[model samples]
Target: MPAKTKTSFHKPATWSDVAPLLVDVAMGRQKADLVVRNGRWVNVHSGEIIPATDIAIAGGRFAYCGPDASHAIGEGTRVVDAAGRYLVPGLCDAHMHVESGMVTVTEFCRAVIPHGTTSMFIDPHEIANVLGLEGVRLMHDEATAQPVNVYVQMPSCVPSAPGLENAGAALGPKEVNEAMAWDNIIGLGEVMNFPGVAANDATMRGEIAATVAAGRTVGGHYASPDLGLPFHGYVAGGPEDDHEGTRAEDAIARVRQGMKAMLRLGSAWYDVASQVKAVTEQGLDPRNFILCTDDSHSGTLVKDGHMDRVVRHAIAQGLNPITAIQMATLNTAQHFRLERELGSIAPGRLADFLIVSDLAALTIDEVYGRGVRLARNGQLEIDIPAWSYPASARNTVKLGHRLAAKDFDIAAPKGTREARARVIGVIENQAPTRALEADLPVAKGIVGMDRRNDVCQIALVERHRGTGAVVNGFVSGFGYTQDCAMASTVAHDSHHMIVVGTNKQDMAAAANRLGQVGGGVIMFSKGKELALVEMPIAGLMSDERAEIVAEKAEKLTRAMRDMGCSLNNAYMQHSLLALVVIPELRISDVGIVDVTQFAKVDLFV
Candidate 1:
């Protein structure tokens, strides 16, 4: 009933003013606002569980956390009997993109609260590419107004790769400095230009210098699997944490270089299983590692879980539940220098925690944020206010003109019948794509789709500038084998329209359809629309509730399956198809990018 005070979470400086009141409650001079009794405290700090623990909260913070809170309780105090359940610190997602959830920050908070994710460190570079600094400001204010802790990392790479593609907006060291002064910006977002950083490029190094000078952390994205000198050079460049490791060695190398190894298990990326082996088998310090979901679509957030899902998956992958919990909670907080703030259930910390019936299974029975009971039994108990994006933030799908089947034509050499072309080979359930080559048959000078080898057409349609420039390329591994096409404006980094189909007509239809409704994902099959989840907000996020988006996303997944595309969380793969920062090959507005070389390559070899 407390209106879920934002000052309690966002404005931690106010805690200095309120700490005296909490001290009074601890000393039994003042009555506590809320108290929990007879619970097993999963003390992440000590890596052990203490039984029959009692906690007293005042001013949305823990005043007393000991065996008994009877001295602090009074007639005005609201008591909740834990009934001998595990009292765990609320889970925290160290690194994520709120836009990846296909919902706004408020909606994302609402969806994940029931799953016991009380805190998130989000990098809004996706929106930064669309609306620039003003766009980030909108989300920052929204994040600050939430019932939970949502920290923003200033986007370090707006275009992601400098010359590879053009984003809607551009940010540099000046923008980074301006954003560092924000109340909620904990650090600079993932320094994705690993090549630039390794080479000591002025802009990339300047942004890192500014973030470090501001005394904030620098998020890392060393997508390269090579643990050689390039990786060493990047680590020396001052990125404190990295979530791009997809191998056990990658995790080991990062932690050895004094960077936090963030093990992520998003809807599509299964990096945790391979990387957590660094801790389980190699016996590295688990504290040097963190857990995160780099990107999860709406369905994963609502149907599965958030950080809770990641923690459980880690446990199932030979990690101790308490250690996995530590990886998700205290480790993350410590990475962002928030350990003394909200990662644990200690005195002087916010009363943000969870009541779990099973630690190993992570069955969250109740969720709390800043001492407020936000959810219970996998359902939200309190109201999470809705946030509306301004008109400037909507209708961002700017296609210069309607596209037709001829627009997707990939012409071959004048006299060639079959041409060897460079193709972006998608690896299933992984973030990295393979640079593949295939000989394709040419029809009327245009390259044709190879359905027998599961290859289809992938094009990046210019949406930001409305140039109507369609960059055509080939991609295999979706297993799509029908007269179907899937298009989305949720293209990573640049937020362009990525259209993939076995038939060019359907691909053109899908692109034109998104142009009509601002932006979103759509699947067109056999000359009919199968599914559409209208985002309308910068072509990335939906204004609808989390459940509605999740349902539509489910239908979209069904449509992908119906069209013979069999890849887990294929939507995530589709979105990242245009992310040129990640290797080995990707399509961009410029042309097909060979991410390994970080340069544009000829479509035909």
Candidate 2:
């Protein structure tokens, strides 16, 4: 192997001037900082792969890309022997929540960077709902400190669904205005209150106005699948992109309405395949489609993959490889208006690229961020420090007292031997759950579980302010045969304690286990606590390193899989029990929310 040379070039006046800079770097007249030799460059810009190319980087940005080696190389430049690999741009997740990883922003970055995710558009809505504007700022500041690009999107729906469940703190239009002016804020977070937008609610309109005034993107979440008048009304509300689509038609409708359709593949949500078909088969313009992972837990990032998984799934859905990569990279960057700075591996863009053995397999042989090698062969070469959350974020699981089985008992209508109970059925690989009604036998004026119908017990323990209130209900779809239970204080948006179980004792044990560890996810089986992932910060995230959190999360996931539950990515479904926005039925500190109507409803009809 010959020694590589360094090269440098002045900023080009136009895209037409790039060829001269490429020649200068290749001739080594100007020293380049680093060189990657002999790779298949997947140019997402032109949708072509120029074979046997070399890439040069300087000042953390791509300085040159071509077939020659003489000009760009200098005495001190570092050379990476690509040895015939596919060079692809690092992925960018269009919309996501860092808190969903059960780790801090820094930890989440550490987990995903090695998997070739160099940028993300994150919404701190979960923390904003817990700690208010201060929480959003905290996450924003931390995100900026990372070496990779982690753009913040100001939370638009702090309460998620007003009047349905109360958040610890709320954000109004003023907060939105202030966040839009922040330096690293790319846009407004997901407008979760879609109904409010369609209804022309003043608060929702004000928030949108603030974002538009600041020239920032307004993210969307039209969770309802009904493409009726309400959907049209929401389209008129000015959201630039939407990731809530689950079907091909849903995606097509969004694009037709002038919204970027962000198809997603998260831990629990397998929505990309059904929706990406809109681009692959329906003749929809692929430029309007984006790829994202809305809520990937640490286990999914570490043990499986990050945006790489989404890209692979998209390709598996019959999309062209380059088109799928473009969705994860350039399309997302363009959506956030960061295309010039970070998307493609070209001049003036951040030098983030993945060296892969095969384009289709996406076997990342080496990963680079900010013009430096960060990981090689699926292992991190750099060490990222653990972040410290405030003491106020600790022990958020403040139930006033120890919980008992009686607290979980849902009483039937007076003097009735049987009553019609409202049940929430968990849907596999989807966010929308079913609203089921079942008649159950009564014992001591309390409705008993109808195991034949797969109805199990679900409880929401009030953690904020130590209310010690346990609102219990019934849920179906987890075919738990043994006396097993699972609990988590990492409930979405509100960070409350949610426990689901087939046995009362096990449910109590699971809830108590999380309480003992401040907060986290725990599973109890046959009187033994089987798994726990301790998230001590706000009862929503662990302060430990990402790898540590990821390891624990992997165990918890395996435990769920071993317990006779086969719903794909059930842990994510477990975390959303307190998400009051998405409808059908959900539990919160107030009680069960009939999400369809955005109101509190009695557990027993």
Candidate 3:
């Protein structure tokens, strides 16, 4: 009734209520709050750059956007001279996990604001796995309070793959319906349970029904490469947007099925190059393609850029500058059904825009959100209030006991000198891993890593429920040459502890060190600590500023390199080693999972 009584920093007033104020400002009956004059407006709606444009804003919404806005300018108005720079809509990230940046939502906003990302559609499922609905609520509140528009998508799949792994929390139809009523919720998050949806599972379908009934978009994750019946069946289940496509064919299929194809580029996921070809090579309408950074590392956010990086990559893939900007801006807004609210420089829309000095290289000179200058020349112009997570959200790294070096021992079958084991093969800059078979040596009843074969031991230590259970497996492709171990509590979907090491004692020390510090990633080498990034919030995000986290992340990557590991952003690959939903192979608290089969398999095959 009456639009469900929602109010937040993201949606402070309905356009109907603001229309009168806009009319007064545009007609010079009232002074505008802010004005940007003498610019070239990049009209996403018309697909043209009109020179000598002016825009007037009042009440955080654009009131006049035309050749001139001098009529609304008054002594109180804050006037910004664009000096003929291109006025572009503030970039939008259509799909992302804020926690993937390893920082809280406030810090994420602070980090990306200077790079021209004014809106983000974030999925809090990573937190939901650790703290359940309480965690989602915490992130939802924090996101709505930010200066930029951060819309929450109620996490659809918590455990991600039911019956495959253990998660700290679970969400069903009840949680979905409850979150739908939240003031800042934009839609349901990526339905990671693709198999369940394809199989017509009632619970999964019912979550989609609830979001549709609430009139919100449903995010999709068809991680499989198959475009046959299962893919069609999943689309029939009602997810209207997907960011999991890693190929041009994947993008074509998703768009053909009436879903917006989101090409993502993040710390490790280099998908935009392959999938944007759906538009650049296949001649599909570019409007159906959206750009996103599904999982940006903190270092990438600070050193590189956020959505700005994605747009640049898309342009490099041979898209016109306006077309590339549309993929990151207007197309994203249309996909989320928020076109009139943001994503374009037009009257009655939020005054979220960027001043750009170059169209092709896309250099952002200033960033604005809600008619307020947020950043200029790649620096924050205002203070973003710090947000604090409650104590319950902290201290989430629960190890049932102080893990001992002996606990990491993978004892081979008695009397076996060597063991033929299944190993997860890590491919550089990809989410999926390869299932390979390797022969490893065993000594004194324990299986040892084969550094000669580039194989190491991987363990999934149960953090949720703290059962003290450890699932052991072998993994390759890290190329470690010394006594080094790395452990992380930010395991995907389930948030378990993933430990990969060349030796047991170092692995044990890495795991125990995380237990001592609440939660985060730690690397140990030769009985010494190498790198640590403290993620105290639900074992997924740090409460500090993103710059600080970025610095820590840089040091962490350097440590990985020093350990002789040669993968691009190997920490991202390490964190996702336990994501049972992605295909080929993965490890979980139960055992190693053959994701293509979605079934648990033994280590020694």
Candidate 4:
């Protein structure tokens, strides 16, 4: 009897099977799955520019890449004419969050695939804070089903900063260990509790130990600007990489201490240029650094590019084009320890690459994933099946009762004409805010917003537990000239409801509007609802398609601008007001957070 013949598609491909399959294709025993002829390959590993190469793929992995691949091709093999285009490795986001895009995992994937992003290491901590273990599972399950590589990092900090803010759900060391066992989980998410780690808090250390014991990476988030003992202590606590660095020194410190400095260029966080100077001008090793977009809104992802935009920005910041590409592709993959599988265009790596006409402009004309064409000409060519989130993942907003104007009223000191109040000042294009103090007038026994001073009232309404607990503080960033308010349930780290407005009535209307729509961003001006962007999933992610969501987000941004808020991506800035982790001031259901002091301070002084 003749021996049985092995065939492609007999089973799911693994690393062990790739070699044999490549050998079969190279020897002409089995046909190549796909072939790309005549392309200049961007060799990130060797830092060389090799031109006119043919690449053969077998079982979704690169079989051979050389001057010619005619022998590997058979009658049934698919061929892609590169037309002398540059075959760069698929872009990888080193650190990011799917929830930050205000879309579900599937939608976010759909939006970025055309931008040449193939691999993403996402931290679902935003949902983890809202729905806990269950929310994480939803993001994880959906991420695994996507066509692109979406690896989950178990959220290390649910509330982000312990004792600072209260989250709907909490994740402990046990939860961290359990998530590490997940099939797609790569490592621990950003350890935002820098204070906890620096102070040798048992919980933070236990979480780090659990991830390290599982042989996975521990992500970092040292948001503080202190590069002194506190920074060193946090580094000693075992975080493998950090994305919170804002200056060149921050990057130098992290890389010098054997940690990957992940410089981010999100819509609001312009941190890459300052940090990339560490390598470009200071002549540091570029391999130890990575580029990422920690928080990009859907509007930014749709209008601007994803990793491609980050790479271009790095290039504009004086990084060589190849070096910038390496930062986005190879450096990112190495930091996540996924280099062998998904970073480069090597023989054993997955056949994920981009065909670009212009390297400097990054004009991506085609994107191939696992040797199959996924997108072309800035549009997805393949179908990404819709993922329907369960009812448990929807309608998470639980305000309990309708909010009233009185809920946002700030009571002044008895019989006082004016009083000094602490204000959470929003900074444009940055995460940290100024903890400013303002002496404001009192009217009808209530403190009033000073529109002339840009001081608007900010409130954090409890949504997770339906506790009707509203923490009020003053903010002076959105220059509201009219009686308008903007409210959203997509507050970072805590995922509570944040309402900022010049008028108490408008603030109440905006907060109640989100409750009515399950959860989303709502803007009200002069007793009329101006715009609403619904995000029913965990009050954090929208179930809509990317284009629709982007349109709504644009309208929302326009509405904010119409209401006199001039900050770029003001909604993103607004949503982060409740992020008690970053300094210098923030709001939580507990009270106003003095992040610089790491304590809750009185709203009135």
Quantify all predictions' global Cα lDDT against the true fold. 0.92, 0.84, 0.92, 0.90
Worst 10 residues of 2 by lDDT: 3-12
Arranged by lDDT with the best first, the candidates are 1, 3, 4, 2
Indicate the TM-score of model 4.
Answer: 0.97
lDDT tens digits, residue span 46-156, model 3: 899999999999999999999989999999999999999999999999999999999999999989999999999999999999999999999999987888899999999
The parts of candidate 2 lying over 4 Å away from their true place are: 1-29, 561-563
Summing lDDT over every window of 10 consecutive residues in candidate 4, give the lowest-scoring window.
Answer: 3-12
Clashing pairs in 4: none
Instruction: Indicate the TM-score of model 2.
Output: 0.93
In model 4, what lDDT does residue 240 have? 91
Instruction: State each candidate's clash count.
Output: 0, 17, 0, 0
Tens-digit lDDT string for candidate 2 (345-419): 777677889999988878888888878777888877776655577787676777788877677778889999998
User: What TM-score do all the candidates reach, one by one?
Assistant: 0.98, 0.93, 0.97, 0.97
